[model samples]
Target: MINRNNWRLVKDYIKYRAEIDQVSAKTLRLEETWLEHTLNWLGEKSIDQAPRIRPVFSDFVLSESENKYSSEYLRKLVSAHRRFMEWVSINKEGYRHKITPAWLKTIKLPRQPEEEREHEFVSYDEIIQIARTPIKSLRDQRIQAAAVLWFLSGIRIGAFVTLPIKAVNLDLLEIYQFPSLGVKTKLGKSATTDLLLIPELIELVKRWDQLVRSKLPDTSYWFAPLSPETGTFDRSIKAVGENRTSRAYKDLKELLDRSGLPFHSPHKFRHGYAVFGIKNFTTLAQLKALSQNLMHSNISITDGIYGMLSNGDKKKLLSSFSPATSSAPTDLNQKLDEILSLLKQNTPIKSE
Candidate 1:
């Protein structure tokens, strides 16, 4: 068996290829994490042990450990290993490879059952109420603006955190996702998304522009970090990310407590957008187009992710005889707005 210490070359190869091939940083990060973990576990201390990796990596991910990682995480680990090793065997000579995941048994993962995933967002009233909530400082207001932008645009959170200032077109009242600026478009393509309708988000963003970007002198970086003393932008490379996502969730949970409602996630805005599209001013073709704009490979992919309709929505689509009641008009309207906004605008989200 090859020693474990020689896996750095493979890791470096992945990182290097990902950079040149325009692969998503998120993908590279996951692959690197898995490779590192597997190498550490197998006592592989160097890059020379490329061949011995497949079995240990596969077994560790597929095996049931006491800590019990989620099936979904294991799936990622499996996929990353497969790609890296595949690259290794092809790029390097005679690295004995025996494992292939295509033949492996399917991993059973959790399905949304009776308690389906929610696509909830702040209601108009809730938004208004939130507006009235005291803002102690500029940062609080800025974060609130960022949150509202996600809801208004139905953007995925991943693209929003990395939003550069130039990607947004205040003149057009839209934010376009551009991969060149590291904006994570649906399939890493640029999208000019509609964001004009949200007066609240717009006004705050404009204020932020005057206060932050105007002075920061960084045209390329939208939503750059701000300094406390100057209130101008900072390029510390630290901004809203997964950790911010967790923090946002905690804050949202606190808000939910005040509202006496169950907490939802940052991703639900995307679902809200889908439900919105299906309900108002959107046809099947339009849905597919929207999905494509969102970087989905196919409309069916979009449906697979956000197709679970609410009971009320189902009843409306089914028939009057069905048990499901149509949802309230206003509730449906919000969903529709989100869908249409993203569809019509095709603007970039800042969550890269």
Candidate 2:
């Protein structure tokens, strides 16, 4: 059981995060859940007691590990506790000296397992297969279009589901992810994203866009909710609710099942977009453009997430490499040197 003082402190910390840090409600809820677990584990001990009792913290972590909790779960718990401790140190004069920076450094989970680090993404062929699958209803068609758009644009599911019809410009191949326009972009980030130039997929997305635009107003969600009675779009619905992503997820899962394709979460489409761009776009400029399209802050982030090539791709690429010779550097070598220089600088290379 948590002591009343500890509980009150936790609530105060959460409120600070909400009002001062301005974190999303979803993030606050997650932090609260993780902090609750920490408090429960601490039992009669207060938050300040956690750092002093290093062995007790290790034991708690051991217990959670035995329960097969993921490294991510442990990481979040560590973050939540660290934030609470920092808040306590600053806000509560009594605990100021207890929670030191060196003590805070002790609050860390073990390194993640190698298997957990392996990346899994939807393949290009898989997206094409899903797109080509026959649709039995208008909802099915919309889901297909959404899936294709996700692959082409790599917008997060949150933004995709909350995207309004007005934000998507098919003619310019641009998607304006503005929070002010009600697009729920991650961290409230706004960017103008470009669609991949796949004509067949572009046409498919356009067809759905045209249909929705003709029926619903610009303010309405492009992936509009269906009316239960009419079995058509609910025109009265202007904005998507919080449960929008869950409903969209379920619909996508059903469509994947019907199409006889294995289900990959909406996020996998984002990985697919990155992988496709990396494989197809050879120039450093093109790679930078691809990173920008994915809305990543830097190319290093993009490379870190989607850089690994499959075993077969690696084998093929290695086999195709030219034999080393004591000659002047080739164009490929010069390009690689330039890429290395730019990567070291950690800057975006502009396309010519």
Candidate 3:
């Protein structure tokens, strides 16, 4: 029941996003898919009619809610529609009058459910348990190393799977996530990321690095491909396909199964890294370093994503706070002021 004109407008908006915005193919596809849902909801009405028919948009939300779409998905759909309408208002004549900023602001989704908001992060103890699990083969060893590296470096799985042997420097505890070197970083971001200096984790990574380097050339993937017949490192296979993530995910699942541990997605390792740093790093200066190491653009981005404490942790933190005295230590007061100043500036703080 999608209107042909509306569909055409959607296509044009998608084209603009590709040619002008230059979003990643994955992001472009997601935006297109989200718009298709909007078009279906539009039915016989054109895009311009959306502003006048507010109830129709509410009906669409109700239908999606009944269909059990996640709040996150609904939020993204709203964002996509807002962007599309903004584009239409700017580029298509007469849409400026119809798709006003006020109408755009009306497009919103409700807050996420508490359960959905509370996601698990892989803990340091869990990583330790995984490391201690006996390795039965070279493949097991490789997966174990990959898990350790994922938690230590806190890079995305796409970048991890695509990392070349040369990009990792175990001795320096650094990972070069340069797109030019073919690391599939999110938004093509490039950074020389530092690995968390956990001695046990570093040792495991070192062992794997030495094995991979000795067997394969520098250009080869650090997570080397294994032979189907022998189930050992296949040095001849230098490149990985787009399906590498699927394969790597399956391997991680298998490793977790073997370790007799509950499954957490590879991306949870990233959350785990952030949570670990947030808990341990007390000063704003230390936190700034942690944020930069995670390759976040700014401290606020890092804080917004991983700053919230769990209910239990928050309770414990509040309970442990002592009664305020008439006067505080001079050094402590100075540090508190410095932290507040840096936070307000939204800039990195220098370590004292």
> Could you give candidate 2's per-residue lDDT for residues 248-330 as a string of tens digits?
78889998998788788999888889988998997788888888788776678898987676676778988877666433568
For model 3, state the Cα shift of residue 69 in Å.
Answer: 3.0
Candidate 3 lDDT over residue span 1-352, tens digit each: 7799998999888898999988877788899998877887788988888887756554577576785877667778888877888899889998898889888887776554544356577889999988888999898999999999989988889899899999999878999999999998988889999999899889988999999899889999999999989998787876768688888899899999988889989988888888889988877888888888778866778878866766666788788788574346887798778867876775777666
- Alpha carbon lDDT of each predicted model: 0.58, 0.83, 0.84
Candidate with best lDDT: 3
Pairwise TM-score winner, candidates 1 and 3: 3
Clashes within 3 Å, all models in order: 35, 0, 0
Deviation in Å, model 3, residue 337 alpha carbon: 2.5
Alpha-carbon TM-score of each model against the true structure: 0.63, 0.91, 0.89
* Model 2 ranges with Cα > 4 A deviation: 54-59, 116-118, 324-333, 344-352
Task: Please state the error at residue 210 of candidate 3 in Å.
Answer: 1.0
In candidate 1, which residue ranges exceed 4 Å CA deviation?
12-16, 19-22, 40-59, 62-64, 96-132, 161-166, 179-188, 196-224, 229-268, 279-281, 310-352
Root-mean-square deviation of every model: 8.3, 2.4, 2.6
**Candidate 1, residue 232: how far the Cα is off, in Å:** 6.6
